[model samples]
Target: MPQATKSKDGCINQLKIAENHLSGNYQEKRESYDKEEQLMIYLSKGHSPNDKYESYDEILMPIGALLNNTLNYQEKNEVIKEYGLDDEEFKERMRDMCNLGEALELEARQEESKRKDVEHVRNIIDEFHCSLEKAMDILKLTEKERQEIMPYFQA
Candidate 1:
């Protein structure tokens, strides 16, 4: 048996294929299929050309159902129910996912602030031809901030 495609590219490709197929572009009849049919078509597209995704149906079906914007709240709940997934478990997982996203956003913002601080220090040094300490002092950076950016100057 062929291994299932677990890469991000595979998942993205499958979504696109499903979207096109359900939009009536891939079939002779448009909007003739139900939500379940749409999901099967999406899961069938997997990664490899010949990938039947025998093992991924369960894993991918819920994701497909959730991501399909055409499905309303009741439809999504129905589809999810068919997979034997618990409502409370799914809700908990969604909360976890949201927390992870917020954490990642915070980290990214902190990194951007650090980069801007370094850039400001570099600009001050170049414009005034002063030492790192003098440039940092001109910017009124705190001791902790200076220490944080010190390695960047060394690099």
Candidate 2:
């Protein structure tokens, strides 16, 4: 028999519990029915498990802990210490991950802003039945903005 039953609701409930714990909204202690569940609970609380991971999913626990926004630097360091990782190396890797995440978020925002600008320009062209340059001129778009949206018009 499987040690723990897998269900959508169960997974969601577990996630909610973890989120609550991270947010300081849940303070009650819960029992772990199995080793896998225990490991998950520990990971959620930034506590490292004693046993080595036996599967790919288990291996991702530390990564998840590292990426968790609610876990402070000290908590993350504790996780690294428990996992027996090199302190400096793990801290550097964590910094890289943080920088990458921030970069991706900034890129996404820029793309969205550009998309909206393109849509506005298209709307202007449709409303005025004008050329692209004329529509951009009416909108008073800067040279950089016009250049950024030019590729959308070309395609």
Candidate 3:
């Protein structure tokens, strides 16, 4: 729904299939699903990291023909579906959904806000710790006893 930013391995596998078909060098075997999945996480949206079907089918068709002519329309459909986009309309649907630049700015703002709050929080912790130390000095709480009661700070 949210432009499906996460990598879909099936889609990348389809890309790998395309690559093998194009190069005729099958030495570049498929990666394990987990490795593929991890790699996908690192790619920009839509660019499959390991392997990907070409963005265009005219490009894909030639490759498809080379791969034993094994154009299993159903399997392709399934991979396309997992991506939530068809070869016909994938790019259009992906458009305008994610603004990476704006997202980075927003993330920076949110982090800045969070950092400000955390600074205050750390100050409070420092204050409390200081106060606790002073109180402990007053009460002379032993180190073992202080550790046991650390959770009381949250309240």
**Candidate achieving the largest lDDT:** 2
lDDT of each: 0.62, 0.63, 0.43
Score residue 9 of candidate 2 by CA lDDT. Answer: 11
Residue pairs in candidate 1 whose N, alpha carbon or C atoms collide under 3 angstroms: none
The reply for model 3, stretches above 4 Å from the true place, is: 1-97, 124-155
* Model 3, backbone clash pairs (residues 3+ apart or across chains), number: 2
- For model 1, where is the 10-residue window of minimal lDDT? 36-45
What lDDT score is found at residue 118 in candidate 3?
41
What TM-score would candidate 3 get against the native? 0.23
C-alpha displacement of 6 in model 1, angstroms? Answer: 25
Identify the runs in model 2 with alpha carbons over 4 angstroms from their true place: 1-61, 69-86
Rank all candidate structures by their TM-score, best first, as comma-separated numbers.
2, 1, 3
Which has the greatest TM-score?
Answer: 2
Model 1 scores a C-alpha lDDT of 0.62
What does candidate 1's lDDT look like per residue over 14-75, in tens digits? Answer: 22233344453454554654442322233222343222335566666666555544444555
How close to the true structure is residue 36 of candidate 2, measured as C-alpha lDDT?
28
Per-candidate TM vs. native? 0.46, 0.52, 0.23
